[model samples]
Target: MSATGNRAAREFRAEIREWLRAGLTGEYAALRGRGGPGREHEAYPERLAWERHMAAAGWTCIGWPEEYGGRGATLEQQVAFHEEYALADAPARVNHIGEQLLGPTLIAFGTPEQHERFLPPIVAVEELWCQGYSEPDAGSDLSGVRTRAALDGGEWVVNGQKVWTSLAHEADWCFVVARTEPGSVRHAGLSYLLVPMHQPGVEVRPIVQLTGTSEFNEVFFDGARTAAGHVVGAPGDGWRIAMATLGFERGVSTLGQQVGFRRELDALMALARSNGAIGDPLIRDRLVRAWIGLEAMRATALRTMDGVAAGAPGPEASIGKIFWATWHRALGELAMDVRGAASTLTGPGHDLDDWQRLYLFSRSDTIYAGSNEIQRNIIAERVLGLPREPRP
Candidate 1:
């Protein structure tokens, strides 16, 4: 907050932009769609190449400590880096789960051995990982997950299916939650384990999305084996571990989306003004509301990062998820109106090509990680101290 700090942060941003412009080349730009030369891509190698480029710069894990292949950036530095990268139209980083969830949880809870094994490559983009928490019947109620993991001669044998797993088809590993003990109360018998996806009995089946592109998968395990060393916490202790990861997912990961989405929102506003939608009172009011919501969400995310940096989880993290999801949805709506009939789905080169895809994707914002409905329940019961609903 100091003037000196502001100057330093600004200088850091300038340095990053200069570096990105120089090294963010035509081929990489074409692959990841930085400028007009690159706009459309659906290749894994391209994303990997771009991730490697950023990781080598110590810019991949911007918030991570210097010891773990990161730059030991401050919270402001991380946010600024995200925004600046996004505004530059840099290619998307592939190891989002690593940088956002797994790395943070490992930092918080992993043993020195675990940290030494997992942290460096993740920051260096050497390995890809995915979440394996949700099951067929336990999408929203994470406590209800029934994937079973039984200890067999010191190794855990896991058997179950995880639906809606993002990037598991290509992920080298997954952080799975399974019922280590059956017949125990919900949330009590579960444990978190990191599974190598390439091993036996782990199958990743991609599920096609509304965009005609598959970004998630259905992972089935029939006696998948994981070492005892892979366990995150004690058996029958996954609830708290998963909650910690979710808190980070909602707090940290959501902030990344907010930073990126705010740029899109700004572009949307700019387009709206150019299209004369700014003259309409209703459209203007909605845009004003969106801008306000974005500012509030960013502030809340800042507080959450501060909490994480300070070794304390902020209570406002839950509410911030709901706010940003809703904020993005609103922007999507405004984007459609601004685009007019162009919102009608069309192939690339269409006036609203990006907007249409984003609009559909925004619908899932409230559903993934944790649904907004679940978030509201947490707010009502935990934050508001409301009486719990009576059980059947």
Candidate 2:
């Protein structure tokens, strides 16, 4: 970047830093460190209010185009925004699915009508969104989805079950990938439908995770209805649109995620020192490796964001997913080791400490989004141009 760009970025950084420092006071002050993966239950109502407060101030969806209720922030500005937000320890966002995933997908693939209806609510945080891609029979193999949706009158009637749906109970809408053609299989005959979540045909059952939290859920959609025009792309083109959404999923917010990782590593190192775990050379070595891994993850993320800036990410996004998921899961293991025997115990009423929650929740990092196995397959087949895996 030129000196002019540097100066602008510094100014942008300072603006957000001052805003966060000033806004995170009174009621918002307690929300600074609340609400994230496995801990979405933390002060959620307040967090929702806080996000709206941000939306009202034009802080949400800064990476989108100005016409789409965003600031039309450049990639550099977006990175600076996320980095400063993390550094401020602001509450984890409540509308990540809508802002980061669906909004971009809509901007790239949605029609004008779709845009006019959806983008404003997302920008305003008026509606929360969730993803409905995984099914009981098809987790990471997205093409194997068995959910079915068919046109009925002027609406699409959806029927299926979606498992491991994050924040489903809280979401007012869901972007679902379902089979639209009767005989279609694999990646064909699918359509991406945006369905409402509060209808009588929709039921959200919370799934208890290792952290004993209900952030993940199983959603049953029976005769759930959406407008005929709610499809993101043309029918039978959902595979492409869904993949694009995944690309957006792996985009800029990851820089903020890395910031949180750095914080976790720092706190764990401090705990190790206090608990004498640092005396163990093996533990010390793991801590050092964790720090090194975080640096590598950040570098890879910045490089990948270039592709995102150009357009939707390609198969190369899988590389960063595999790296961060594996690194975070390992960090969890190291957290347990750092805690020693205390890792096994729980407080009265089975309460878990922050370290324990980290260990348990990080276990799913490799599984959700896309599993390690799925990510490697994507890398081998798509990124590295390896031969396709033999199918039965």
Each prediction's TM-score against the native?
Answer: 0.90, 0.99
Candidate 1 residues 93-203, lDDT tens each?
Answer: 678888888888888788888999999889889999999988889998887888899888979999999998988877899999899987876779999999999987998
The TM-score, computed over Cα atoms with residue i paired to residue i, of candidate 1 is 0.90
Model 2 segments more than 4 A misplaced: none
Model 2 per-residue lDDT at 159: 97
lDDT of each: 0.78, 0.95
CA lDDT for candidate 2: 0.95
Q: List candidate 1 segments past 4 Å from native.
A: 1-4, 31-41, 251-256, 274-276, 348-352
lDDT of 2 by residue, 262-283 (tens): 9999999999999999999999
